[model samples]
Target: MTSKGLFVSFEGIDGSGKSTQARRLADTLTARGHEAVLTREPGGSPGAEEIRALVLQGDPDRWSAETELLLFTAARRDHLERTIRPALAAHRIVICDRFADSTRMYQGLSRGDLRAAVDQLHELMIGQEPDVTILIDMDPAAGLARAKSRQTVEERFEDFGVALQEDMRTGFLALAQEFPDRIRVIDGNRPEEAVARDVLDAVETCLP
Candidate 1:
């Protein structure tokens, strides 16, 4: 396996089924007798959940890109302090829906040069990263359609339209290239079971 138990995170555009797949993988692992701790970024812990509401439910321009990024970082920091770090310490597989990678892509789209700032914040504030990041790669258009099917105030970012989704797709792909050892790109254009099969396949090999 990779280490003892794995700290896995699912990454992709909003509608790439990362959240669903993260849960599915966690459930699968539990059914197999593994202690998989399922969580999500910006809302895993109580403090973080408060931040999630602040960040995700509001006008599209409620917060500037920089402000929004900091909020995400803060929520992540809280989540780590209260949720993720403890789970990893207990040797449980932690499968998170989204992590710092989403911040890197979304904030980078707002301002291309902000990646430097985001990286700095991540290194200084939220030092830990996922052991394995599974990127559910999908076409921006198709993913957008999937995202829109859900009605939520989180539509702020998605309302930016196809161009933003396109850029995010490119950004996430580049991330896979940058962190090849820690990241894996999986095709998300398949059936749920097929996608779940591939996700679990990627995870099981690294199982403790």
Candidate 2:
């Protein structure tokens, strides 16, 4: 089912301000006379929300890499069926805070064989790709610091230590390189407004 809408996803490390930027971008698009739907991964729909809590709060030490990937894919499937695909079908711009990229980064960090995982998962789900993916790149230390400052209670992934988080950041960069046509890496070390503007510009360039 094809539609005249754009799917833009925001990706980044823990504290790259992707959530904030995604909202700003949606508001900007709406102000420009476009219908924009702001949603997020792992919890876009009610069913996905339950899966999200399980994935986020579960013990990381006990969770296998394969298990993590499957849980993420499950949530994503629910999100696509219940939220993303429907919104796109209605010709509304969909801005997601995080999507498949997060699974690649997180699971890729824990598991070495990520290519096969991505291929298999994509083949099973994700019929359509995002028109643009704005990657808010930032240093792992800085990102984690920001996340720590803002959060009162840390989650499982947040407890993965700095090294794993750094690996995840690198993983995101690699994914961006692999899909350069659809991914735009933006230096997220700047002010929030500046980053938001850059994201908006990238989306504008990609969308019709």
Candidate 3:
């Protein structure tokens, strides 16, 4: 990696296996002798992790769409300040599980028509976009099934049901269209190794 470093975020509907791919990419890069900082949003830093517990482990409607947006934005700000920026400054590859695009979907488009507000907050506070974004495209039904099968308490979003997942899948694909240069969509219905290969290919252009 160059001194400028590289930021890569993985995005998908619940159970799209993006987290796995993110970790695999990080491990792959590290094995190649590159310093990679693997992290996740809403919980990357200490402060953000606290915020994560609040938003993730509650009733589906524990927080309103707007309130959730604010919470997510605040967490993102702290993450940028305390974790992401420093790692980039040190020239490490930042492999993030999710980023602003998530807020754009979950709290913005999917929850309500808060995309405008989401963008406004993002530009005002977290003015950084990942160099590359890997969007794992998966069937909403399948994704929701996988998500529910885990039975994790963080299923507040998943608890919203398959309809929400379907909407999110469409919204995510649209987001990829909106930012064609940065977001690359990969089919996640395939084997993990195959998905990881495509992910590596998507990111290869940005790597040193």
Candidate 4:
């Protein structure tokens, strides 16, 4: 990736509209003459996509939390190599729908306590973080309602119900505080246009 490019990620609870906003931001950047590569977690690259099916499909209890962590880390390493890094090396703005932060939140929620392991694994195998992260924050109930409307085969995490979503919101908010320098939490309960504007403004601050 060229030194001039920026790396950005959009993170939030499942139905918080982070993925939509990530796409919108990439479109905005492209309209303004920047090359933005928009991709999603566990499936951004060939190998990663393969891993995504394994983790996102089947029974939610199919894989142990520790085993799940290994799968995600492996996917991330592949994503970085085949997708993110090359885009950044070319100076393109890399806008990821989800990244390592998702791992910390999801695994922590499932296992009750595994965040330390997530961090350690990330540092050891996938050390890079986004130049900026836009976290779409909203009520968990609202987000869960939104999520339930979708028709996806990847229903493993969403099946955890609203209670888990509430816990996930807390986890995401905590992550924002822990990484204040790079994380920006934006209210995502508003219209998509409003959220898109906020996302754009947050990312623009980190751009060259």
Most lDDT-accurate candidate = 3
**1 or 2, which is superior by lDDT?**
1
Tens digit per residue, CA lDDT, model 4, 1-208: 2376899988899899998899899899999998889999988999999999999888878888889899999999999999999888888899998999999999855455898899898999998999888999989999988987896899788887888898899999999999999899999999999888888888887777
What digit string (tens of lDDT, one per residue) describes model 2 on residues 1-208?
A: 1356789999988887888899999998999999999999878999999888877774657577788788878888899999998998889889998988887778855455675776678677876678889999998999888887776443677777688778888889998999988899999999988898889889887565
Order the numbered candidates by lDDT, best leading: 3, 4, 1, 2
Error of 2 at 89 (Å): 0.7
What is the alpha-carbon lDDT for the whole of candidate 2? 0.83
Candidate 4 Cα errors over 4 Å, as ranges: 1-4
Candidate 3 local lDDT, 119-187, one digit each (tens): 999999999999999999999999999989999878899999999999999999999999999999999
The stretch of ten residues in a row with the least summed lDDT in candidate 2 is: 108-117
Model 3 lowest lDDT segment of ten: 1-10
Q: Which candidate achieves the best TM-score against the true structure?
A: 3
lDDT of each: 0.88, 0.83, 0.94, 0.89
| TM-score of each candidate structure, all chains considered together | 0.96, 0.93, 0.98, 0.96
Ranking by TM-score: 3, 4, 1, 2
What are the per-model C-alpha RMSD values against the true structure? 1.4, 1.8, 1.1, 1.4
For model 2, name the residue pairs that clash. none
